[model samples]
Target chain A: MSSFVERRLSSPVKVAWLVALTWVGCVYALGLVHQPDVAGDASGGFWALVIALWVVATLSVAGLAGLKLRSKPGRLAVDLLTPFLFGAFLFFLWEVIVVGFGVPPALMPPPSAIWERILVSTDLLWADFRQTFLKGVLAGYAIGCLSGFAVAILADRVPFLRRGLLPVGNFVAALPIIGIAPIMVMWFGFDWQSKAAVVVVMTFFPMLVNVVAGLEEASRMERDLMRSYAAGYWETLIKLRLPAALPFVFNALKINSTLALIGAIVAEFFGTPIVGMGFRISAEAARLGLDMVWAVIAMAAVAGSAFYGLVALVERAATFWHPSIRK
Target chain B: MSTTSIPLVGAARPGLLGKLWRGNVGPVLVVVAAIMVVWYVAAVAMNWQGVSERFARMGQDASAGAVFWQTMAEDRPMLPVPHQILVELHKTVLDVAPTSRRSLVYHATETISATLVGFLMGSALGVLLAVGIVHLRTLQKSLMPWVISSQTVPILAIAPIIVVVLGSIGLRGLIPKAIISAYLCFFPVTIGMVKGLEAPDRMQRDLMRTYSASTAEIFWKLRLPASLPYLFASLKVAIAISLVGAIVAELPTGAQAGLGARLLAGSYYGQTIQIWSALVVAAACAALLVVAVGLLEKAVMKAMGGRP
Candidate 1:
């Protein structure tokens, strides 16, 4: 029996099966025998079992991966399955712990409760999204990106401005620009406009620095070819420099997507009318509405991920010819 | 082609004056001078209403020069001039004792302390996570996507929740603020370290394997050293963000001390000069911290026998 067990462990497929079985057993223990009360009031033994099961499941998954799968599909399957299983397990643990332990709803609401709150407050969430993401973040991102690109072009034309502006750009980048949210609110008043202004300020410097760096990406040989073709500054820039800069420009876009969202939200915290994600979070948290706050967080996470994913997808398409993507 | 036939521009021997004019300092000074001029003009425009209102209340017909001067040097203007902020900084830093609440130095220390604590916690966690992720494919697969997705959720939106939750759990003040700072800081470090750890080419890693080096041996000799440059670059970013985190964390808590509080207090009383001074001090602190990190990187690289 010992030899049989050792032989099975030596095979990656058998090890994967063992991991699955262990996971099933852990889930059974968590769900059936040691299930705590609605208030999560459970004995110490029950909590101990939960912790032990977590450790076992974690180890099993790690063992399954460490043995190393030979087939590409097998590796891909393990990679895909691992995070999904881990994520599900974490959520399960969170739900069980919060529910079974009777943790204060005010301090830590269960995922189910937050989900219900999200369902009930769809309209409110939509309005806040419109206010923060649609109006403030998007508008600011467009303006900031355009101005950064334009200035980068201008700086490329003028060596003096390039030297002068790059340092200034670096200096501004180091400033905790999010701290300017309050001042921006004061300047532009307590509305989405103020938040948008803050987003612009937060995002502008990053884009400028990135585009300036990106503009230098074209190789000397490429520029020489342009020069040989008798290309003017505008022609060389448009045909060679700009294309080479796309990867860096997209990097800035990806970065600024998060920055813009953060700026708008933080700006809302200082002062805002009834609607916006930041305003909602601060307001709900103040009222001890932890569930509502979580709901808003879920919204922000989805929106942010979608925004970032969109930018990345665009980058992939735009930079397909680049060696980094070609592989 | 017209361009192909054009004469090549040769390097010219420049006089001292020409060299000075073409240098970085000259351009930077010109830009700073331009900004100063613009700021002074904007200050006058923004403060004109308050100046005029005060003059009217006094029932005095002021000359244009008096208006200009008063606008530039108001007791509490809507937008304080640069000199006004300078005066406030001098008074706050020099006139009062550092321990005083009213002094900017006290608040700066409080914030900086939190920032440092948070940065240490964050960097330690980041390096550990990177090490784990690099060794364990399971973690790399599971943790990396989540790590990438995590930053999308703005910490500012969640800062209050963290503060209130932790506050209720009987943890308060510095720990909560530091946690927020760590949250902001850890992402950059993790990303950088991951890239850095994986930086060693396949041949280099295979060399370690050929020598039958232990995992720890490989990590210590190859991976860690290779990751230093990326680690330091990210460390600078992390430190700056940590400061921002400490400041933002102060905002939601209604904390009595910190740079964020100074800005808040200034805003409450419409003390524009106070706000501007705090901002300037924060910027200066960020600059100093970045320089400090750069120096540390030099020392670390030198010790590692890498290029400084």
Candidate 2:
């Protein structure tokens, strides 16, 4: 055991491990008494066993972290893994405490309950995925981005509009979506269309602002060259302004991708025909189906993250020239 | 593409209204006036139920006098005429009892409290998290991605969960709403402050290092001061976002005293007049908060040696 410890950990790490082990032993000796409700479960002994393993895991973390700190070349591993370990630790503690104490699902469901629900509710999950991800978010995002891009172009072409519109755009951009979402619901009624309308409003101004800033990129020399070449407005735009604006436009697109999902989801919560991720999450929570609620939330998170990640990848590809994406 | 154009004006001297309305004031007023005029006309002509509907079909146009009369008509559903809304506002703010639910001031105070509490908590936590992340590379990676991603989780979805869970545990009232508000507001502050704190070029950092400045000194004396502009800008945004969060939190859980609950109650009962009045109050609340931020920003900037 000592050799194994030496191979894996530095002196400081070994000391920390020894300390943690001693604490774990003390905790074990102090007792494995459970709550009156949970002390009778078949898995009480199993849980106490898991609790002991948690100690071992905690010690391993301290040992690894210390080893990483003392090394000259391995700090990068520590740097990346520490937060991951912390997050995992948080999840572990949550699971253990919630289960060990036999907390009610209605109040706070265990992670295992959430996982099990996710495994079972494939159909309801699919329906929500279709309503939110496929129809509402995608449609709203496309229309919002395109409209913002077109308006930005017009704003750019007309000097008066650029001066006149950008500040107003800024004001409009600051308008909160909650203020607008219900209004959209009132206007469009309770359907995916209303939800899509909310998404559009949420996304439009941000994209417009980004695209406008982006078009300001070309240098004086570049514009002068274009002028000397006698390029038309569209010619100059297609060749130069639009390309320069790609990074900013992509920035807006990435932002709006998430915004669109959020808008659609939130819109559904206000009033819907009993479908969509937001609706399901709301309805399930109301019913005290905590596991199902988590299942829907997990689905929404995955969908939202995937959408954002895809936009980011596209941005990386398109803006390879941008200083922000260094080699 | 042209780097420079002839300046909008030859010199800095403003021509009266140009000075008062110069930065953003004129444009905001102009837009408000235009919106009001359109709303008044649509109220009469379309007989719209409320502003929301009028806004949906708002692109249609009419003459000024005709629009004016149409707005005054009792039949309008979508557009409440300017005069009518003013009367309603008068009743809510000036005429109604101070403690009445119908009074905008009382409701506004309640909403404001939630907004303030949430914004402070959010801004404070955001700053703390930013400081930690900047000092520790371990935090910057795993947490940064999660922080950004956390935002994508619709507050609507999470609010219900929070309210339900917290309510079950006998925790309700201002704190729950404030927690949600803080969640929304903190993201911008964190992201912005991180950028701001790391704003200095390598040369400037090296200069600081040359003086043998400690991390705390370097942060307090150099980085913190440098990050003020970014911090304030984000604060302005965060405050507005927090108000929205507070209001939304009200919606999911139907608090008795919030602007959100008023809107929800009005909508449920189909009280168009009440709904419009509450909306006006909310919009005014936002406007006031923004104006306050602008004032604070100007003061800070002025104190910071008046634009170099």
Candidate 3:
């Protein structure tokens, strides 16, 4: 290598530095405009606060850029720090823009407000999580997916049923979740179970369709080879078709993971005993507690990501041979 | 050639309906009929016990099936009986009453108008975000995972926050709905578009480069064209999600109108039939929107010099 070890900082890093300097000047100018006597309550001094925060932000960004400007190991330190600093900057920007612009807290609570809510209301969030995620989503996802896989297997065996069922499944899919959610609540009552039922309905058809397609993924030649070995349908399905179908199955799984979460959450909006993300969001919005609503949102997002990540990990393990996974 | 001849053979045959029905329609019908029969029988069996007792108390000795149908008919907005919904739809479509909230047609038009606008805005945002992610590999790497993660955060959980945030900022009505719809619709479009845009081969890109074309030119000519299948796939998904998003947004704001408002209104008053009818209308609307997208996909594909 000519000099692989002696690389320069990326263009983004240089831009970050320039941005830092400009932001510092703007903040300093803004600080000058802040008059303590004229500052109007929390609303009035918001701009000055943003400017003060910007000053701190500039220092942090500059420090990060300087670290990146260094060579090798030092640059690596910046690479790790860059994301955290960027995240901080994003939170800062969100806070300043909303406050400085005099944005209503009801619509978009500042990041600090969201964090405060998170800090104060761990127990409520946990209960909501248990209702929506643990009971509703997990149960519904498992049953829906398992039922879909089983039904798809049966449909594959009975070709006529396949022809008959798929269109109807498509019909079922076209029924909007909102349309069915309340009815489910009526039939199943106002608990996690109703939400679970909605999830089952929402997830079932996609999985069924995907699995049906996945079952067909085994090539004609592969099936012939399996047949030549005197294998039965079940044996061929298990040993050959199942392996080939892993990627498609996992595709459905990943898709269902999202759908299930959505279904469970939306279903709760129709009716609940009141401890749910949907309920909290609805109630909080009514109360104009935008910060608490945001806090709940953050929890849902983290949980959702974790659930998706778990599914993705399982997918990687199950479909290691898939080209998409390999990449 | 085989594909061309298959439908031709069906068209050429007399008694085609019977032949088609035997192979396809018959089984589906049989299944539905059987399911209905079983349901009817079960209702008859169960009707003797639960609701029958309640009906008796009310001086009504109705059969389980009759009570079920009556329940469906009486259920407001969302849970309308299949027959009642058909009747209400007729009344609505016929425009029998010009000035009543009870008129299904009036409510539907109002809701659909907003649903469509929000849907269009959401889809546009999704497409733009997808383009950005696809064009910037770093964004694709960093933002893609985050976008996927974003959905896990329940829309319900965030809808109020969004509604209140916007409301506080003096933004209301369609904007909140559109924003929520965008949140739902964008993720699919972004992921789908990223996959679609990258669907082109290295050889294709190299050929484009040989023409001395700018990146923008290459994108419009090659990347975008290659992305059609993916776009359509996601558009269907995005559109449905957009409808749902619009509905959810309605929930937080307590909007006096829209399908969501209708649903909430019915639920609050326990107007089960009204709720059912509204739900049916919404489903129909969603289905129609999906079909419209499918039709547009066909037109676009045909224009692209391929058979739809």
TM-score of each: 0.92, 0.83, 0.82
> What digit string (tens of lDDT, one per residue) describes model 3 on residues A1-327?
101211232455554665576457455534433334322223545556566666555444444443335367766765555455556566656755655555666557667668888988999999998988999999999999999999999988877687677777776676676557777887688999988898888889988888888988998788888889988888998999989988888888888887888788777778799799888877876888778777877887788878878988998888888888787
Best-fitting candidate, scored by DockQ: 1
Candidate 1 — which residues are off by over 4 angstroms? A1-38, A63-78, B1-20, B53-58
- lDDT by residue (B5-87, candidate 3, tens digit) is 24555455548766766476766876677666765454444333545566778998577676665543332323333466567
Better of 1 and 2 by TM-score: 1
> What TM-score quantifies how close candidate 2 is to the native fold?
0.83
| Top-TM-score structure, candidate number | 1
The global C-alpha lDDT for each of the candidates, from Candidate 1 onward, is 0.85, 0.75, 0.73
TM-score of each model's chain B: 0.94, 0.82, 0.81
Report the error of model 1 at residue A109, Å.
Answer: 1.5
Per-residue alpha-carbon lDDT of candidate 2 for residues B1-308, written as tens digits (9 for 90 to 100): 24336456667777888764555566566656777787765555656334334544776454454445544654324545667777888988999887897788888888888889999999999999898778754356547766777876654567778777878889888888888889889999999999889987799889999999998999998898888889988999999888888887777666788888887776666556667777777878887898898898888888877583
lDDT of 1 by residue, B187-265 (tens): 9999999999999999999999999999899999999989999999999999999999898888766789999988877
Instruction: DockQ for candidate 3, please give it.
Output: 0.40
Q: Which of 1 and 3 is ahead in TM-score?
A: 1
Assess the local accuracy of residue A79 in candidate 1 as a C-alpha lDDT between 0 and 100: 76
